[model samples]
Target: MPISLDKVQSTAPGLVDLAKTAKVSLEKRNLFGTRAKVAVVMDYSGSMTREYREGRVQRLTERILALATQLDDDGAIDFFVFDSTAAHLGEVPLDNYAGAVDRLTQGRRMGTTDYAGAFRVVRDHFGFAPPKLAGGEKKGLFGRKKKVEGAVDVALPDNLRPASEPVFAIFLTDGAPNSKPQAVQALIEVSTAPIFWKFLSIGRESFDFLQQLDDLEQRVIDNADYKPIGSIDALSDEQLIDALLDEYGEYVTEAKRLGMLA
Candidate 1:
């Protein structure tokens, strides 16, 4: 995935005159596409019962349900609840989230938290386009034999992905940890794809677990050879998750339009 300065200059000759343009091309090789399969992980332990620090106590699961409802033909979404064990929130070929949320709501739930259990179940399920790495330096999305730096929906390893499509892992946690490194290492074995582990701090008291949570964050970032892209905070169920999902959807749609998702 080494940069081809000459190719960039040729593709975008107009930018060749810019300073340092030869060092790094502006053809935008860092783009994503629509075919991504998304996995949503939630913490459903007894500790998560408190308000999400932002004053949202009652019907807390409803907020997450609302986020799930936003997912549809856009991509594959697997909802999971983690406690002393991990439970699949819905059946496979699970397309719409609204119904899935309802079904999960009906399922009895209660227990101590086990982050490792969740990782064991869903980590390996994702099929992220491996970022191109050469001699260890990351290039961009890993997929497809054709080398188009801007191609977002690049193919992925069939053994790792659903069939060379866009893939993602979204982990929602109260940032509480029973076993730190072990839980994450297990997840690495479960799924070697790009995972966006979001540590959603559940309540004011939950903030005490931030360091443990940060350690887990570093675990993924350090192993993946990249930085984590989320934070722990008083939960604010202000449709932010939905907004981000929508943003991703828009990007995929646009990428598809530009032939990035193909």
Candidate 2:
């Protein structure tokens, strides 16, 4: 079971309502009582400066933390901020998540976007092995030309490590990655594990590259979902939660069917 309602009210009174709404959202998706490790990965690139300053990042963090209170056994979400590099900001607990965005990004300088670097950090943090990249040049995440800087390697069959639970990762990015091939390869590798990636575009970008995750044939499972948020402020809590969790229940069911989770 998740954290009790009594604890939520006492520890983080502001999130009490949001947590209640999340419970209802989970019930609607038939994911009530589901237990998973929660992660929120934020893009700390130069383009995201406006959003961060406008408090949209903080708003989203609070919302995700509220949802995490219901899904994660520890009532916290592992947090990461990334750009050309990735930084593990540690866990944002239900009790101390109010100013997480500002607190974590206070002294950090925004860098160029590097989705693959951030993905690799998450993969390693969760104990997944690095995936081999096939030698080839492919369209980059921003539609730019880029080389996949590695030798061709044969894809292996699914030999994922056994785990008792799944990981729900919410990745927020405003634009395309510096290297699309690396990002794709990262997803392919983590697909074998029990981690589901939910990529949310926090800007007006189409995120065409992310949409391909549904049909990417290199993975053992469909482990990702993408949604474009034109404006974060426009969404009510319910609407935000719905978009964030879209297709997640199905992903969990499929993971169990494939023996990724017991």
Candidate 3:
């Protein structure tokens, strides 16, 4: 059966409350005080089959897209799916997000989960590169051009370069990562950049490894945080947003103190 876009938009349960809570959360934390970019990175491995089929992921995506519409001027979100590798699903418009989420979940499932791959894709998408990292320009795994020039720009004074918009990446997963060291390394490299990673664990799985992300050593800043949501249906929209952003308020406060985020 075909789903009408209007019906999908009008019938989404808790959407209004989700949007309201999202706005309140952002305002309370003073996050993205200016225009910011939003991205949703979903784990599409076999372990996530049940959540996808149950429509939890789709509903969550819709709510986040609603948040994006309120926080971002463009009102669109960049979407990506990861298994052994990550694939960009393009920007989903707020008005047509239901169709986009449906299409994102309608694909072959990959066997393993690779968090590093998804982070790499996002870093390249936003043209972020670490200072003093030298390598010949090559195409990104997703076919986007990886320019070494972007690294040099990172060294320039804030006044010299164009103003940057902070990026909030919402990563949803259901299990442990296949490569922990690589994932930790990627997070460390982007810590100084204007990007914040909010990782949400779906279902009742033990996310012990993910919970330790904040304890990692030798980072410019604590750039990521994790929370487990046993069931999306169990929480009110406000509660859901609060759970997802539990650590984000402190992150933003510390980021400002360190002069990392404006």
Best prediction by TM-score: 2
Candidate 1 vs 3: which has more lDDT: 3
Q: For model 3, what is the alpha-carbon lDDT of residue 207?
A: 84
The regions of model 3 sitting more than 4 angstroms off are 1-14, 30-33, 131-163, 257-259
RMSD of each: 15.0, 5.0, 8.8
Tell me which of candidates 2 and 3 scores higher on lDDT: 2
Q: Model-by-model lDDT, in order?
A: 0.41, 0.77, 0.67
* 21-103: candidate 2 lDDT, tens digit per residue: 99999999888898888899999999989998989888888888888888875878898988888878787878788777788
lDDT of 2: 0.77
Task: Check candidate 2 and list the clashing pairs.
Answer: none
12-71: candidate 1 lDDT, tens digit per residue:
333223312211221122222123445556676666555333334213333333332222
The pairs that clash in candidate 1 are 35-166, 36-166, 37-166, 123-191, 124-190, 124-191
Model 3, span 52-136: residue lDDT tens? 7888877787877767655576757898888988878788775566767778656566678988888878878887655333234
In model 3, what is the error at residue 10, expressed in angstroms? 10
